[model samples]
Target: MSASDPRPAAPRAAPALPGVAGNPRRPYVRPMAGWWLRNPYFVRYMAREGTAVFVAAYALILLVGLVRLAQGEAAWNGWLEALRSPLSTILHLVFLAVFVFHTVTWFEVLPKTMPPLLVGGKRVAQSAITAGAIAVAAAASLALFGIVWGLTR
Candidate 1:
């Protein structure tokens, strides 16, 4: 009836199932609980996605340290001292493991996400692409570490 369409409005009722004899009800919805557990692929995908929580936690911890540094040397020292605790060390170890897994999974999916790369009219292998990416990341990390260490010394 509005300015958009010339046809009459369709019925507001839910569409009936084809085999249902009586009046139609809402469409059936499958249970969502434990869906990720049913498939190995889903499990790996969920685990990869779930690592974001730990990433966010570490980011927040660094953010707090920045805030403490801005407050003064005393506050910054307190933050540094807190990070030296046994609990903090254990938490960091766990974060390291999770980060390693997350990085590997992220790199594994990089080839699927990007357009096919043609090398001399042939497509490059995914394993090569993934290994190249990981190598680049490790080299960058090492260079950064060396720079920082040299500066600190």
Candidate 2:
């Protein structure tokens, strides 16, 4: 409060500009809320990032199952029963869709995120790289499913 103080005075925040009319020279500030909804690219980016929450939730569910398994038969059976519920089945389907969206979006950006691919002194197309990665993922998923089915049978 006094000039003798070594500390500088606190700076004032800019007044809210809700149409009261202020300085004409002030730079225009874009509204931050719902900006992603206006652009398809940002919408897709947000949705892809949002899928991580579902992935984490699924991982937690699996961790809980592991804990229940370690607790012995009754706890393990209870966890299995919980998963067998209609709600859990529907939730798993929703998770599956979100996971597929996440995977596709991730692969679409793979070319940009990774080094260029070349074969026989020729660069591969981005679409080819995306398609090849998706194809490989699908094949691996199918192979794993087949192995699980064989074991369960």
Candidate 3:
């Protein structure tokens, strides 16, 4: 090597920590191995899937109701009576929680699956759509509950 070769110095990496050896950009927070389980997205996913269990139970309840209705007025009354039972009430409460979760999550994902909507040369957001759907569901549920309660009374 000649003394006067005039070679350029190599580029240096930034320090990892302000006082550490190398890497300047803040260290990215990588998820742990089982991160999916702990991730908010995954939490929502699990909640969404969990709703299925409640849906199944709700369907079973409906099936029981249908069976009782078919048996006779006495049987139907018995089914109604069972619905008023403590266990049934608890199950319904759980189902209601799951149902709300399912409805919210379902609507939250609706905008993603469907095509975008444009009105007045502006793009409508997914959140807005989800909110609208949720509002509609809530209104419908309340209306139905009121009608049923009115009829029963």
Candidate 4:
């Protein structure tokens, strides 16, 4: 109380928890099971993230085809014949769907991840940016397809 007092001040006590006997040390952890069900956005994001597995599987399939091609003409032809089967066709369709979902989700998120673009000193709209990105991707894809078709013909 006095300005010249030499006695150390008493340490303050921890705040008491109501209805609980002692302080709990660990924080509660949420379980990850069914986390995607919590919100529509989370579901969409998770579905987009899950597409990577399918994409990787498709890439591996392509690598296998390349390996078969290296084995000989017979092996390559066999792989192509196998790919012509109903099961392979179904799998490819599913992979294509997943790839499309992944691409759309990626474009949707691109503007958020990247710095804002300015066109003629005005900030570009996010929707326009996404559309422009998709258009560029489509053009590149078509060019690649044309090149491949020309080479194979």
Candidate 5:
């Protein structure tokens, strides 16, 4: 117990309990393998999350398309032609379905994640909020379609 002592003092021991068991380990409970199958909500949530894989695949496809486009008109045309193949069409259909599922689920969960929204001094229904969001999305999509159509024409 001198100032020159470089070694740290021994740590205080934990107080011994009178009745508590030593080395008490938690019991292992087996997880339910098919828990999601038993509940519709769980299935829906899992499906919603699974759409992320398709979304990522679609993003990569788009990135490849962009890369092809950058290469030249020939490369871009080749990529476009490849997209017209049956396999590509099927994949696109699957991606579209997954995208729709993701979007709908996102809207459904949005209200729960947000604080209660008030309109006209009353709390707005979740359905109303979801509908409004979908409406806005549809409008934006139509606008983009129009612009693209006009440019193509």
Candidate 6:
């Protein structure tokens, strides 16, 4: 290749997959400082991922309960006994934290995701929407707890 060859400079490596002019996708690049914290997408992803962890743990608790029921009354009692174990206690605590965090974030995002509810010719405010949702969630949870308590007795 002669120095005088009439050719454009070698095109820069194509930006990763589905590359766009302005929003180039850099799939494998390491996130720079604060990228994880500052990026809204990453924040949402982390919150969702953490919630999944807690859900899995909670499912395991339910699974043990089911197994206990399958094995008759004695096994069910043992399952309840195991529930008092320190490890299970810790797991439940962690799950409670994650569940609350997920609920808060999901509610916060509801206004953005949902269409505005109109009442009496006026659009409901986002804060009001969130508050209403929280109230409904609390009521449902209490109802469920009561029903479960009733059934177990």
Best by lDDT: 2
Candidates 4 and 6: which is better by TM-score? 4
lDDT of all predictions, in order shown? 0.94, 0.95, 0.87, 0.90, 0.89, 0.84
Better of 1 and 6 by lDDT: 1
What is the C-alpha RMSD, rounded to one decimal, of candidate 5? 6.1
RMSD in angstroms between candidate 6 and the native structure over all alpha carbons = 8.2
Model 6 accuracy (lDDT, Cα): 0.84
Worst 10 residues of 3 by lDDT: 14-23
lDDT of 4 at 47: 90
- What tens digits encode model 6's per-residue C-alpha lDDT throughout 22-65? 66664466768777688788988787767987788788879989
All candidates' TM-scores? 0.81, 0.81, 0.72, 0.78, 0.77, 0.67
lDDT of 2 by residue, 54-130 (tens): 99999999999999999999999999999999999999999999999999999999999888889999999999999
lDDT of 1 by residue, 49-97 (tens): 9999999999999999999999999999999999999999999999999
Model 4 misses residue 66 by how many Å? 1.8
Query: Residue 46 of model 5: what lDDT?
Result: 93
Compared with the true structure, model 3 gives a TM-score of 0.72
**For model 5, how does the per-residue alpha-carbon lDDT over 1-153 read when each residue is reduced to its tens digit?**
888999999999886554456735555666889889988999999999888888888889999999999999999999999999999999888887778778888988989999999989999999999998888877888899999999999
Q: Which of the two, 1 or 5, has more TM-score?
A: 1
lDDT of 3 by residue, 8-109 (tens): 666796535743456465656776777668779997797798789889878988999999999999999998998899998898888888888899999999
Error of 1 at 151 (Å): 2.0
C-alpha lDDT of residue 137 in model 3:
96
Error of 5 at 94 (Å): 2.0
